[model samples]
Target: MTIILAHRGSAGTHPENTMESFVAAEQFGADGIELDVHLTLDGDIAVIHDTTVDRTTDGNGRVTDFTMEELKKFKANYHYKHFFKKTARIPSLKEVFEWMKGNNLICNIELKNNELPYEGLEEKVISLIKEYKYEKRIVISSFNHYSLVYIVNNWPEIETAPLYSDLLYKPWEYANSLNSKGIHPKLKSVSDTIIKTTMENGISVRPYTVNKERDIKRLLQINCSAIITDFPEKAVKLKRK
Candidate 1:
């Protein structure tokens, strides 16, 4: 069966990377949630996608320039003001972890450090997973394969996946080389052949941003390990039916 992972917590229906969105994903019966994490000025793990808050929040600056206290000031729901009545704020990784204690959703935590080079990000995320005892429920992923490699070397108990947008010649072999349990590739890069071949070699293939009904049905029909989508509600319905 294919598991549905809400991309940034039902981003199509709610604010991306906010607590409200995450809660909604769980309510919609998604098997898991996928989110991104960036380091704040005070070294806290802030769970927003972009390097800057300008796009997602009312604030105009880099996420790394603000302390967690400062980052909390900006409403993280700038994009969906018309759709939702309540205000949403950026959530820390700790806060999200605390919320996870109330449920059993597998979390795919993507490290947003490929561009900025956030020092100690891997350590910080791994430490929190250990602190919360969420080792079995977490999957650490990154576009920066080096970070994934570091996690594989230092924290083999936790699972790590390589996130790529481009086509790799043989991703399964690459994943094996990095000791990764899965590969999270762009939706276009995934074909039925890729899904079958990759999983046959003992590696899971999870595509990102898969929201189309046709695509969702196809992946589910083929028994994809999981799909990260903006609309978990729709995907869940299709999977169940």
Candidate 2:
């Protein structure tokens, strides 16, 4: 069965990357939750998708510009009205990891590269995973090769997936170079030929942002290892039949 990974923790329902979203996805029976991490100016790791707070939050500057205390003041965007009354604010990576320790859900942590480059971020993340003993349940992904390489070299035990977009061709080669366990590509960017080629090379292929039933069926027909979507409940229901 294609794993149903909740993109940004059921982002279609709650504030992406918030504890509320994570819990909601788990309750919805999502196989795993995907989230992004950015390093703050004070060197603290926070869970946020964008480099700036303009889109997803009430704040008006780059995430690096605010300390953890300052970021807490900003209100997160509440994409779903029926589920949550007021949106929750941004959460720290440490807080998320602690939440993971008690929950049964798996986590896919994507390191956002736009902010200050997060020197030694891979090591720091690995340390936290080990501290929590979640090395087996956690998978690290990144668009930056350096970050992926850092994880592969320092924490080979943890699964690593390299995220790629259509702008690049033969993205599988890049994942292979880093000895990644899987390749994560945008669903629209992957073709049947690309899927066959990637699987033939012994690398698992998982696509992102796949929400439509037709697209989900086509990806499953081609035997995608996983399909990430904002509506994981829809994907899970479709896959069941």
Which candidate number maximizes TM-score? 1
Give a tens-digit lDDT track for model 1, residues 1-241: 8989999999999999999999999999999999999999999999999999999998999999999999999989987898887999999999999999999999999999899999999899999999999999999899999999999999899999999998787889999999999999999987789888999999998999899999999999999999999999999999989
Which 10 consecutive positions of candidate 2 have the poorest summed lDDT? 77-86
Give the per-residue Cα lDDT of candidate 2 at 98: 82
- How far off is model 1, as Cα RMSD? 0.6
Model 1: weakest 10-residue lDDT segment is: 76-85
* Residue 222 lDDT, candidate 2, scale 0-100: 76
- Decoy 1 TM-score against native: 0.99
Candidate that scores best on lDDT: 1
Those runs of model 1 whose alpha carbons end farther than 4 Å from true positions after fitting are: none
Estimate candidate 1's alpha-carbon lDDT, on a 0 to 1 scale. Answer: 0.94
Which digits, one per residue and each the tens of the lDDT, describe model 2 over residues 114-217?
34587767777888889989988887888886778777887789999988777447767877889898888888788878887888788888789888889988
Q: Which stretches of candidate 2 lie over 4 Å from their true place?
A: 78-83, 167-171
